[model samples]
Target: MPELKLLLKHKARTLDEYRRIGGYAAFQKALAMDRQAVIDEIKKSGLRGRGGAGFPTWIKWNGIPKQKTKRHYVLCNADEGEPGTFKDKELMESTPHQVIEGMMIAGWATQADVGYIYIRAEFMDCARAVKSAIDEAYAEGLLGKNIQGTGWDFDLHVHLGAGSYECGEESAMMSSLMGERGMPRLKAPHAPLPTIAGLWDSPTLINNVETFACAPHIIQNGGDWYAAMGASTKNSRGTKIFSVSGHVNKPGNYEIEFGTKLSDLLELAGGIKGGALKACIPGGSSVPILNAESVAKAVIGYEEIGEVGSMVGSGGCIFFNEHTCIVALMWRTAKFYMRESCGKCTPCREGTDWLFQIHDRIIKGGGRPEDINLLKQICAQIDGRSFCGLGDAAAWPIVAALKVFPHEYEYFIQHGKSIVDTPQSKLMFPYAEPVPV
Candidate 1:
């Protein structure tokens, strides 16, 4: 509850209501200042993208090629398809205008002509909510043609994407927006950066929904004001909203300043649901899982989470209690990425399927003696060689889980069953009869 600056109040839905609650003031403040001044304020506030990468927002905007003749674009990535990550969906549903306002400020900063909030097709609620807000903003003279009499014209639209995890990557998002299949492109140094050449070869400022939602706050509160909230850790400033799930009694979004203890947040979510906490996934299903001890010691900041060999990916924390099988969890994780692979890259398209097969076999009491080594080999091939973050994210958790709980994998191999088999997995199993694990 750390005085949420992003989540809107109960009645803060309409343009008038949001304005009453001090909503669009930030965009107005940004409009009054020099365009560069808005970016400068964000740079000064030390605001990093809340989109899991934690990239500095100003740096991304500053990187956009500033050409007067060329049209620039601001793209808001609302395709929140990452497993266990729902903050963006909830944020948009609660306050679509906030995200839109953030986009307006970004448009002004980057001198963009148009913007799109690419929401996932599965998020029908979020899509409808954002679309309604956009229409309302347009009707109220807040978007499209001379917003608030600032003599600046910016148009925003909602582009619904066929929910694809790979599309969550900015480059893939641009491709999908262009009516192309969602897949990643190789980002080489020789090629122009996306900021310079994006969205049909124009400058595009791509940021996540949560990142844009913070723009107004940064502009209104001053960069230093937002920067001073969390621990002064490198790349870890201001507040973040974490979507906590799995084995938590009160699973939901919890907004807190950085450097808050992970254990404290778990407690805020009412601790483990049915049993003692066994492990935690600090970021999302994509990042590495932390042992119970490491979970206890971990803090809320990105850098601190990284120090524990896990990333604060999209700020989605999924905790599991002792009854949960660590290996089974990894199996589920691998299965998800395998099914979601965009099939553009050779490694990810093939390697992810291979991983799922191995996990499936391992959980079914058919694990080979060399399975661990094989998992290591496949993970190495997929981690650094894939075209985008999706492949790397897919392999990260499995690799980390194997390293942290090698015994769990070994137990299934030796005992011919999952270590923590329960009724749910038993009923869901597609393999041989159960045995001691």
Candidate 2:
């Protein structure tokens, strides 16, 4: 498989080391080009936000208003709080300089005079690394005040958020950075969108760690170099670093081009840990779960994952062996959402709690026949009705669990719990061997 680890090359820490590997040459190239040309280059790359939403990177930057009187901000969303996801944390700690360079490129392209990295407080190492890189950049005239006599001044800062998952959202992140509660804002019409009114109601452009990190490379190696790497399908593009975990024998980060099979990815991760692969969460905790049958058909791009009725969220693939209990797995997943819900909306705040409680009851041998039906009902209200993506994201996997493995819920409802004690225990969605199709 062709791998594109633009920001993963080792020994590229200090400015000199980074320059040796052709580091900020792209920025110099970018500086020479017109601002619109830089934006066009990024747009041509077909790079989407690696932060789950998969939004086009250039469109977000292009949306920044060209008003000199109003402040424009370019932010790097490093608050990687998704369960079963940790790629951004590693990127920040390892290739801090790459991230800084990417941010600088974005700042220049968007005409943003100021930039900030809103990293979670839990990522103290990431903070240190980014802050250290920022200082190094300032000393070398790579950041702050004037840059290489371009007369474009860009100041960068690192703001530590209080480790709230809600703050991972762009709106919530802006709120947390402003020293306010980390809750999602009420999204309104596009007359004054985030590009025009964000982070103190100014034109702001935000991109996740991986998304920004791609900028320097895309600029260095032309848009065609990146657009040619990933799936042939229209949406998912470029190589993605998936944080593989759960039940996999060799769970770790693996960068592969899009359109790879889920089963092939499992082989890359050394297959199932101790038993047959029963199911897998193709994306992070937020996306829907893929059944054993569907997993066989599932591919490794956003469009393909969507075709399987799941999302390529954060590229966090979590495997589950046949021995794993579906109800218990979902119960734990629901509990995470329940605890992490920002309580900003009535449906999400209350609905996540209800989902967790129901899953708990089903797993604890206290489920009623109507429990699964009721769960489906609660998920309906929470799926699209929530204020932010959190509530909608939390409801997706639960709904997927119901669809792909109805027997798991039925078994829990009948037996009051999942008991894989005998061969008879393997009822529906059996994957004793999980052979690739």
Candidate 3:
């Protein structure tokens, strides 16, 4: 109902302050209990991956081999590359120890001997904060050989990525970490899941920064206690931190319970600024765009958000005002995906370029009547045919924008201009010359 501050409860800048606020208590409690018991607690908490997938957290933890013949690894996806998403960056900068402790808990649960936080190269501040926290943990005997005298040895390291959005995908990240090009590898059924073989062909468990940050809270309190907070939503438990930006007075991370209404979350961010709310990209740029009507009734849950034709993807909620042009917005989004396409697969490599080219021409007042259907055809070709999710991510928002704002695309194509005539639209495409209808 309100802003639930479980993970962001404090700016735990130092290990001492973090401990004073009961930070590593969960790792300590996990050490005393059976490893299976730790996983069972996570299962009971009903926690899903705070990453875009929303996969159950415990399933990945349990999937690691029980035999432990091979070296096990715990990976924290600190490369927050999704557009409009800054929650992970905040968590790492403010509560670095919480992230480390969560990874330690996962390491213990899965018997992992080593852990690595794959951070983005641009987030030097976050890398330094987490590095400081790791140094503190080692100094206090909380990490390294014989951690806390429990005879369970775990070492953690920080790795900075070279700023590739494709590397945010799990397999690509694995490839990059192993000194290979940051391209995606073949995934499961055809090959092994990351749990079976990852990061130098060993068992690896990976979760994003926000997902791990929740672990300390889930383990410190009982699982049921965490689950009860978001019981109103079907299968979605606990609070999710949303990075609210664009046309909002307070553009920052606001942690809200799962069942909170979309409008309520908007209100929490001080509502829309500049003009009346026109549409919202409820979850990062990759998810579908929601019209004002859909946004009015949307609920903030994994499945509930899906009901309104969008996913709670990485919790990057961007609200746009009436002055914003949907076509122009989508043109910028397509350009991003096109530049970020890794070119390993034909569909994403070619399709993203085509999508951007179409949007670019349409915005520049050279659109054709058949361009809308052509765009749809390209999206269908790319949606499920690519090697990784980047193709789908590239196609989803374009398809959604076409569906939610058909008139915008139709008008832009038919009249060679945006229907929403505003100063913002002119500012968005300053070089465009209007074609006489």
Runs with alpha carbons beyond 4 Å of true place in candidate 3: 430-437
Model 1 global lDDT (CA atoms, 0 to 1) = 0.85
Score candidate 1 by TM-score against the native: 0.95
Structure candidate 1, residue pairs in collision: 45-223
Off by over 4 Å in 2: 1-4, 422-437
lDDT for model 2, on a 0 to 1 scale? 0.85
Model 1, runs deviating above 4 Å:
1-11, 421-437
Q: Per-residue alpha-carbon lDDT of model 3 for 1-437, expressed as tens digits?
A: 46878888799889999989987888989999999999999999999999889999999999999998999999999888999999999999999999999999999999999999999999999999999999999999999999888888999999999689999999999999988999999999899999999989999999999989988888889899999988999999999999999999999999999999999999999999988999999889999999889999999999999999999999999999998899999988988899999999999999999998899899888999999999999999999999999999999999999999999999999888899898775776744543221
Number of the top TM-score candidate: 3
User: How does candidate 3 fare on TM-score?
Assistant: 0.98
Among all windows of 10 consecutive residues in model 2, the one with the lowest summed lDDT is 428-437
Tens-digit per-residue lDDT, 294-326, candidate 1 = 998888787888888888889889998888888
- Give every collision pair in model 3: none
Better of 1 and 3 by TM-score: 3
